[model samples]
Target: MSEVFERYERQYCELSANLSKKCTAAGALDGEQKKQKISEVKAGIDEAESLIRKMDLEARSLQPNVKAVLLVKLREYKSDLNNLKTEVKRLSSGGNYLSARDDLLESGMADTLTASADQRSRLMTTTETLNQSGNRIKESKRTMLETEELGVSILQDLHQQRQSLLHANNTLHGVDDNVGKSKKILTSISRRMNRNKWIIGSIIAVVIVAIILILYFKLK
Candidate 1:
């Protein structure tokens, strides 16, 4: 039983780390970091699964009596927990803790199995409760691991969006620079065209004046 607990704890830690890494990777803006986190998550998940298999094996090796006792306790605990949950909900809605606590205690079963119920029954009940609680705790821890993974994924998405925005900004700035260069080239071409028009006009006027001077000299 103690070994089982130890195994469960080890797996819990591994699972948590894996989930965190996954979330981090998913949200990572950097490709390299995202890749690394993915690897870490994979390794962690594998390790946790291996630990779970070992725990299952240990559980199966226990005596039938122990298993039966555990089942009975689990059923009882579930019933009690469910009732407590309902009462808690009701109390919460009305903002009344005092009444809720009273209801919980009244519904709860506290060490009710006396010594007369046979040693086998007692042992089974105790072992079953311990094992079931342990399993439930482990499951809850794994749930947290999943939550962490989701968080990492969200972060990675944000990172990617930031990168994309930066790229777009750079592209827009480049376009602006190109447009400015094109405008300067167009202005220079316009100025050259104006200078050429003045030169052509002067040449035409001189030709016309020469023809008129020649005709007048011949007549004289």
Candidate 2:
């Protein structure tokens, strides 16, 4: 790895880890304290973004094989960063709404019917928000599952293709072996034909010579 890439990657990891801790800590805190931690997280997010950009630039500058691997890692980092931001937002919104509801319930108001109406309305709103968040979580899970299944399907296809290639290669080898055998058989047959031709010629020549000797004897 290049020095710049290594440095930026290390820094990004540290920053993201710290942001995750902050996000988890924010869940334990409330009011101004939680808000402060969120602010800090947002700042860290900005810094992480900068580091990611730098790392991307460095990764792109590398060789193709190395660049692909590094870019994959960078995408994971980006996903994690996005998740962190989402979590922080969820925590911030939930805490603020709950805190406000609690304050309202604690107030000493004389209009009991209006207070009841307001409380019911706030409860309904909070319930809707929770439902929306739950729906979003469910959707995210579905998407992740679909992605996993797709990856598995692609791997299976590649495996089948590899098997097909191996089978083709084996068949080709068999054909080559048959071709070699056929060549040897043809060569042997050609040699036998040549030998038979020579033998036939010698027999004809001997027959003609005997005929000539017989005629000469008769004439003598």
Which regions of candidate 1 are displaced past 4 Å? 1-126
Q: State the lDDT of candidate 2 residue by residue for 1-220, as single tens digits.
A: 4557766876776676677667667767777898898899999989989998999999999999989987987876776667666666566665444443343234422243244334434434544565577679889999999999999999999999999999999999999999999999999999999999999999999999999999999999
Lowest lDDT sum, 10 consecutive residues, model 2, at 104-113
Range of the 10 consecutive residues with the lowest summed lDDT in candidate 1: 109-118
Clashing pairs in 1: 23-152, 24-152, 26-156, 27-155, 27-156, 28-156, 69-124, 69-125, 70-128
User: How far off is residue 103 in model 1, in Å?
Assistant: 44
TM-score of each: 0.44, 0.45
Clashes of each: 9, 0
Give the Cα lDDT of each candidate. 0.55, 0.74
Runs of candidate 2 with Cα error greater than 4 angstroms are 1-108, 111-124
TM-score of 2: 0.45
